[model samples]
Target: MHLPEIRRSHIAIAVISGLLFSLSFRLNQYFDALFVYSAGISLLFLPAGVKLLAVLVGRLPAIVGIMVVSVHLGASIWPDKPMTAIVYFAFVSLMTYPIATLGVMRLFHIRKNLSNLRYHHIVVLSVVASILNGLVHNWLYLAQGVTTSEELWHKSAAMALGDFMGCFVVVAFFHAAMGVLRSARNPQID
Candidate 1:
């Protein structure tokens, strides 16, 4: 099977995204500890938002970066875990953004340029992505006997909420930062 081409720019994006993911994840773990409800459940997962932004901008290459980092992180965090389990987790995490983005694209008929993208499109994407990530991860947990049925729905809901909020906060901050930069570059006539 033919693989997607990976150019220098893609590599650059991947490295940058991977670094950002690492930073965001560590920060989230350190500062959002109080918000953590369970092993994979948190109230404000900043990395989720960072992941979304990287996927949006870097596309497939970014996914590759995320995959690499996820595997690395998983392996490092669970050093005793088997290689197979770590790979599995990475695969599952890697699938979330692409599926959500493709689904949103097809559902909304958005162009590659995203010329028609709007605020609602982002909202829809964030919601769908968060739900998919939460549900898929929780289902895996249940299947692995890590979580019981009684805890599944609530855990999924909490994870989804965290993912959505993370995406919202990161996007909002990026937008505001861009606005400030623009204003600084071009001061309004008094």
Candidate 2:
């Protein structure tokens, strides 16, 4: 595709991904830690073939917008800490995927295939995203004074394990769904 076409496609992907992220987050925030899975699934599955830059550019605004809306929606939930919750959500959202991608790139040596949504790329991404999602989030919680040093290591590890497991579950479902959908559209190719 030409530059203009690629730009539009990237924007469209971001917007759609953001919408999906916000919707998932909004509907499931009450679940607390479960939001990690929703987040992993939302952020990873949508922009598979898009470059990381495009995903960031597209989803950041949508996520921020969702965060802003949450300030109002969550006012009733955390009457005293709505802003805190909003800011935490925004910060975690900002930190999770980029850090995860970086970890995958460095650890998996898959930097060259970032633009392609191959199986290995998805696996590495899901693993990295899950691990970082837990670390960044629990570290934030620790910073916020929710956990003391005594529990930091174990707590973070447990959360990371949960996030990774949840990511794989969602990944399996989405991967299978994508295969079915693609096969339906391209029966001859499949």
- Which number leads on lDDT? 1
TM-score of each: 0.86, 0.59
Write one digit per residue (lDDT tens) for candidate 2, span 52-137.
33233344544444445444444654466657775665556456766667666667565443433456766677667766765676
For model 2, the local distance difference test gives 0.54
What is the lDDT for 181 in model 2?
88
Q: Considering every candidate listed, which one attains the maximal TM-score?
A: 1
* Worst 10 contiguous positions by lDDT, candidate 2: 42-51
What are the clash counts of all predictions, listed in order? 0, 0
In order, candidate lDDTs are 0.84, 0.54
